[model samples]
Target: MSEARLPTLFIPHGGGPCFFMEPPRGMPDPWKSLGDHLRGIGATIGQQPRAVLVVSGHWEESQPTVTAAAAPPLIYDYYGFPPHTYQLRYPAPGAPRLAAEIRLRLDQAGIPSTGDDIRGFDHGVFIPFLLIYPDANIPIVQLSLLASLDPAAHLAVGRALQPLRDEGVLIVGSGLSFHNLRGFFTEDPRIAADAESFDQWLTQAVTDPDPARREAALTAWAMAPGARTSHPREEHLLPLMVAAGAAGEDAGTLTYRDHIFGKAVSSYRFG
Candidate 1:
């Protein structure tokens, strides 16, 4: 454990290898703003964390699971990307001890969890991070989202992991605030409006001064304005729940906001 207490974050890991590969069909670098935002994360945190406990939208299991490999591999979960993206390396070591502690915390909280020695970091973990922590020096361990995708359960998962923050672990939720593939790719004019509508609601909920009210708002997120349109499936947005739960009484602030593929997106920081 280190001396610095790290803030919890909900970051938008851009769509599949978007950071490395060229934008499709001459689209103006869709990831520029997001990539820049990610690059600034290291400095924004003030100090390097001893380890990072990440929750990604791409991985899920019947119960909560944490990566346990001493030297975890990259999963290259995305397909049809440029070959270089597959070869991209982020040789960050695995924090096996941290993984063990995760399971212990979950168990103590009555939330069943296990560890996997085989699974690797998915695109959601390695992609945006390629910029955030370019040195690849800090250890990272991934925790799987519950297969049930129950919001409250995920918040509980975050709460269980919150104690690690005091021990110098940086808790991060890596997923998009707006994740509608159809709306993103299609030529519909309503996409931006719909995304913004939901983005505003999410910002309000995440930044709510009252911790209880914030959690309640997030628990019932699907009812928010354009919530379904912003997230047809809540997997991408669920990571925010984890970050918020870990935050405890810390109020959230919107650290980044932008439009990609004409859809509004956002990121949050909580201390």
Candidate 2:
């Protein structure tokens, strides 16, 4: 039997450790629907990957980096959560061999990268996996975004790792479509409008049938409608670039779309 080519995913990880806990006061659990969607992701893809390479928005380095630990720990990486959340764990084992392979691929592409055995799984990786693969059984290797936040550069990094897809490695970019911290808890109606404008543009760009046009649109994403209003800082949005690059000529599909914390959020799958 031939190895199945794994699809690249861009997932929205909701606020903090709250996904594993109850909502604040009367607020509906913002992560409930999103979590449900993510839990079904493995089935949607039709097979379990040998390993998962996660590009988390939470971790950034001057250069690309991969976690090299054999048994990675959990990073709470959130603030003011309830006591139980602080103790929440997703004990997924690390894939050091896979990390080494990532380092090799990045180096071959002339994208500088390092391996860190000390790095742990940040909420960006653990939270989503805790829902999607609660057994914490799949081997995972976390990749870091570059501090430069250049869309083209991140895309190049993804392209460098494209071969991994056929080798049964699922590349997942974890981030939020609209990540303005200032408007996080606010009930202002304008927030939804701003998020929708950006989300719509992104939807069209990623799902564009023409590969050239799709790449071009993503390269100039800041020019999209309400781009700046949706992402005051573009770190959270950069992961999608990596996911798209690895997508190569594969078409993108909007897998999940919903309103979270008063903003429009979406998830995408490529090839």
lDDT tens digits, residue span 22-81, model 1: 766856898899999999999998888989999999999999999999999999888787
Kindly report the root-mean-square deviation of model 2 from the true structure over all alpha carbons.
1.3
Question: For candidate 1, what is the lDDT?
Answer: 0.92
**Scored by CA lDDT, what does every candidate get?**
0.92, 0.90
- Report how far residue 205 has shifted in candidate 2, in Å: 0.4
TM-score of each: 0.97, 0.97
**How do the residues 26-129 of candidate 2 rate in per-residue lDDT, one tens digit apiece?**
97877899989988998887788889999999999999989999999998899987789888888889999999999999999988899998999999989889
- Candidate 2 error regions (>4 Å): 24-27
Say which candidate scores most in TM-score.
Answer: 1
Candidate 1, residue 147: Cα displacement in angstroms equals 0.7
Q: Lowest summed-lDDT stretch of 10 residues in model 1?
A: 18-27
